[model samples]
Target chain A: MHLRTPLPPRPRPARTTRRPLKHRARVLLLALCTIGATILVSAPSAQAYAPVEIVHTEQVQVGPYHLTVGFSKWPLRAMQSLDFTFAPDGGLTGKSGILSMTGPGMQGGMHMGGPLSRHPRKRDVWGLDVRSLSTAGQWSFTFTINGPHGQGTGTLDNITILAQPGPPLALSWTLCTLPVIGLIAFLVVAWRRHRPSRHLTVVGI
Target chain B: MDSVHAPTLTGPGQPSPPDHPPRPQPAGAAGAYTVLAGTLMSLVGVSWDVQWHVDVGPDTFFTLSHLMLYCGSAIAGIASLVMVLRATFAGRVGRPADPTVGGSPVRVFGGTFTAPLGYLVAGTGAALFLLYGLMDLWWHSLYGFDAVLNSPPHVALFISISLTMVGSVIVFAAARAQRWGRIGLVVSIPVLITFTPITTNAFNGVSPAIDPQLAGTVLFAVCFILMGGITLRRRGVALSIAAVLGVMQLFLWWFSPWAAKAYAAHVGLPLRDNLRHMPPQLPSGIPMFMLAAALVIEALLRLGRRRGWSGRWLPQLTGAVGGVVLSFSMLVQTSMLRGGAGAGPMGPSTTSATTVLTDAILGLAFGALAGYLAARFAVLLHLNAPATDQEGR
Candidate 1:
């Protein structure tokens, strides 16, 4: 009945300790690190050149200062949204600047002029959003900077504005042809169906 | 009730047994109403679609508004196809064509399929619309979205849709001649609606240039005056049509923004940044002067009748008068409500006098042209004569 005393009660296995708080903290830290890495990687890279599609950039000496001005889009279209940026050779800190954009065919004082600020993402670059080209022709943008070092002015000129592109040719032609063909078929069929009957009636009489 | 009338030969020779001629079957109440519904749906759908583009920016081809437009085309196409099939089968079975079936069947494409001329034309338009819808999707993918109104694909689509409108006009003309007066009135609303998009530049309230706006307004006023005036001979009929159209335009002016907002919310689509916080300005104003212009035209028609004047140049005359009135009224209303200038598309405060004078002159010329064309259209569609006087003519 004892059955060998039930083989002397099997030794209890060691229980693993649960580190809930510590485990969670480690996981949370890992997640934060991953997210930080992702954000850092995705952020725009810093470069000496302007970030937008630059038509051209040049170094210009303006009243004892050196500066670079850039246009964002090439062959600008009427009412095209773009950006313009100015970078002083020294730096943007302790500097304030204004941009005045004027173009041909634009009314007097119709120029887009605004103060430049450090781009939020690119701290070294001083820029402003130019909402529209507004007119088509040659545009001249002038930038004036007043810094603790000195005040200076520079111009980016001969920026050509082109007419906005129309719909693509192949697609336009294809779409236009469909209705014309259908209309012709309809008219021709209608005429053919009616013509013989009218002729027969005239002959029978 | 359906009845077949034997063809009457008016020749003086002895009467002989004639071959079985295709019977004339005017589109009955159901067909008339179907076309009317299709047209209204098209108008609503097109207006909504345009607003969706303005408010929501780019969207896929299968948006709700597009579905609505396609549904309209489908309804018209199905109704037309049904009529064609019915007539074809009826004729094959040697039975009298049902007057409720559709209009008389004309053999199309070497007798491959027999269908009424209106239905055939409408069906062709529907097919073209389908083709263009696909082409538009492709075109957008290639060319990017159009910020302006007159893309080539858009123009093609408009032309196709206009063909459907023309078919509806012809169908309603036939129906009205058979005493479907209410249907004619109902159909005219859609006709006017369809015409509105073609003239969006005139009334869209966005452009600051006065010349385009003036031309657009003149064209719209002249075309509509001619359309209503030439089709309807009864006193007040043209005016009533114009009034109804104006009311619809007003409703759309109010409804487009609401519908756009609601649709964006329902689909969880974020509106473009520019439109998000801005209060919606009404897209355009109804041509309120259309009613006044219509009244003047009616008065002229009455005077013409009293004086026994021929109606040959009546449409042109009506158009000229309507154009002047509409342009003047628009100028006054815009100037008063929005300040003397710069407030609307009419332009800056400096050129009000020049704009008004120039617009007035252009409107007169365009109105006359539109009147002439509308009169010709009416004659072509057999809508020139009164419904009662249309028999045998």
Candidate 2:
């Protein structure tokens, strides 16, 4: 039985260091670097300012139309630039819209609304570009859309707004001056440092 | 009480001195002063740009502020380029290097070009800034309206402008013996402020637990104030610089809001930040503190002189004491900026006492360290005697 054993079909390949394993590792490293770079470039932080990209939306349904209202930033704040988008699930081909925005104390009515314009960035939806809500309170947007189906109107109401971001512009500015004021007082006290001296020659330029 | 320079640069094969006294100026002095002027213009543009962003909303590459910045850089860049080319040509023709470039101009591009150290640095910075300016256009093109404020292109532009200003400082520093040279140096003193914005940016990335704005404000305030007092050997120099900076700040105050409001009205764009105005992004109130810090440093120097106190630790010790005042003032500044100046409820009084105390102690410690280094830098740059020179006296 031992004599009848056949020779192996081929000798096992030599196990010296080769290109395939190193090549695969190099590919993996490259892939990892790409992912890391992408993450760094794309990851959102407390940026200087954010671009107008709709990240979240609220829905408003009136008559036969279902509209999605999108905001560039969430948890809306006063005095912030944000894009607002109004999209119909059906598409924008045959539709026309007018939007009227009312402040915290304002009343909503047919006379307050107007035609909605296309968002500069969000081309597919009718919206406003880099618009800001001036005061923190409950606000509303009245949308009027006309299409083949018929005219319909809806109100997206009671949107809550937080206080403005950053410090008080005026007060922070006043506070900034405090240090300078102190510095001035100190200098006035030390004014004698520049008094004319016998050894000091005022060189003429 | 006055004496003229006794030719330290006299060499063989060079022209002999005239019987009449020479004016204390090097050939490259004009270029250096122009560079300073250019830097001033650019600084205004930078501050204006910040205001524009907050008021009129996101901007394009072709905004008025950008134009101002670009134009100012062009002025500086052109001046540096001309000086460099002139020096290179003169060097090629076998002339001696300008004394203002450290008595020897630096050779460049395999000896094809030679330039004064100052102009070379300025030219390089300007060129880099130009490239960054181009890159900014690319960034805008790709990103469209509303790019992040602290984008890579913006950072690069800031660093480049700083480099140009450094070159300007070097030029005046190199020729400190001249009457104009001393004046130029004084004019350039406010340039130290560029550090504040850069360091302040750290607040974005650093943890609130660390309280990074304190570090930026401390080092910037402590080092520059002390260094000015030490090197100029005059209390008034720091005060004058502070006054100049304050005036600029005032102009910015009026100009920023007014311009934003006016521009917005003109363009039909809204200026929503009408209430409380804008929280100034730059070192709005910090430099004014330099007046006080400078006075403190001057007092310390005087005391040290009487007591014969001299050592590496001396500046640090003085800085530590003076830093306390500056540290507290900075807290006020941060409160205003962070809380919307006065409009927000979270003023310094509202913050926890323990936290403010922690920041002050830490800032004082850091200021001590920064003061030492700044003093060293001042001494190094103190190439000429501190003089009371008058223009056209």
Candidate 3:
């Protein structure tokens, strides 16, 4: 049997019973900062303001198909423009094809008037060459204008556009995001919690 | 010499060893608890979906707040009940340490399970949103109401299903291969599915063809149950209790007449003739009272256990508490869902404040009951499984 031996005396520090106010204050400050940061990051996107109106469309018919177009506040002189496309169902498809004037002098004259007419009433007469009309039957064309002002969509009937059977129904992008974010957050927390810790241990001789 | 030998034969006693280190808690376990609470909290949507009424006259009483309070309290109460019971019993019926019972396996598997469930909820929500998208496209294209509900809702359903499938595969692979990337994939799928629907008008099938209100209810419910299931499953038994209470509450919900009464006293029309008729449902206030009772009983039992007060009465008291909560929740859910006198939108408000309040209360109270049931069942199952697992041990 081994005999028990007394070890050398060790110094002990003076202990206080009071709680640490500094620690609490630090936590409070951190929490407030987090809340403030969240609000700042999630605010909505800004939009441009402009005085614009949706004007009626002009219709063109070819064979069994038709086309309708319209625009407003399009500054042809300023080279700022508007454009759009037609789906088989008369809905807007893809992005709008932009309208433009050929040259600087030609552009400024666009808003001045048409030909020798030079009527200010016909000023800013920008033209959009609709690529092609696809769908048959009583088709409709809708114009979506995006410029210095906000965006607006307008529809005019009896215009024929490109026709296809139909596109495959795609999933909504936003709905797919919720789970992705939540799982990421969960995993990050798990990793942090499971991190290795350093410590000292007494060794027996 | 003999006497000295006798003295030498006496050996020294063994000193007790230091207690084992406190067991490690599962990661993100607390967050899981909070998530579960939030899920049940959403059940308040049920009251707003349908109205409540008693067998009595119409316009007797009505308010959605009372319903919400009842649901929230019920969930909390049920959770508390199981918690108290477990804490109290842990000391008395302490079993030998069985690491396999609920240790690493649960912690590991739980973290993996949540991602898929989240994905499922998100996917389902998305599918519903897609349906609305289709409806919008059709309505704009055809200029008819036929595409309203079926079209737009189809989009959301498609989104929800696709996401769920992807998330589930990721989760499964993560489990088999122990991949961390799977977790990210799992979590992302659900978040996207749920958030996407509300972000876009694709899920807005509120046209003449479809009841936007009803579709909204279905989508929200699907979202809650799926997400809630994921959250609860992570916690294992605690969630199981909530599930039990939720299921039982359904029974009561289908049958009970959720009653509420509103009395208006004004001098303009003599005695009580000036009262405006709201509906047939009377706000009975019973759900709230029952919720309070469940909580109090749970607390007292817990306190009693902590004080080392044990008797035949304790178990009986627990039983009674669980029974009452279970029955009340069931009746209320049944009555509200089935469409009694107070069913339908109560004027301007589609979702009433009373509904939110009652749901929170009921969720708590029912959660407590569910917790109690889970604990008891878990214990029983634990005891029974061994007998079947190893013969003649």
Per-residue alpha-carbon lDDT of candidate 2 for residues B232-331, written as tens digits (9 for 90 to 100): 5554665666666666666766776677667667765655322343456553644445566656666776787568675546678888877777777666
lDDT of 3 by residue, B172-221 (tens): 22221112222332332232223222323344533644323223322322
Whole-model Cα lDDT per candidate? 0.57, 0.60, 0.30
Score residue B291 of candidate 3 by CA lDDT.
35
Collision count for each candidate, in order: 0, 17, 136
- Candidate 2 lDDT by residue in tens digits, A144-164: 788888988888899998887
Please give the ranking of all candidate structures by DockQ, highest first, separated by commas: 1, 2, 3
Quality of model 2 by C-alpha lDDT: 0.60
Docking class of 3: incorrect
Kindly give the stretch of ten consecutive residues in candidate 3 chain B with the minimal lDDT sum. Answer: B1-10
Q: Cα deviation of A34 in candidate 3 (Å)?
A: 37
- TM-score of chain A in every predicted structure: 0.49, 0.56, 0.19
- Over 4 Å off, model 2: A1-83, A86-205, B1-29, B101-104, B273-276, B283-287, B334-350, B382-393
Q: Pick the candidate with the highest DockQ.
A: 1
- Report how far residue A131 has shifted in candidate 3, in Å: 14
Q: In lDDT terms, which candidate is top?
A: 2
lDDT of 2 at B119: 74
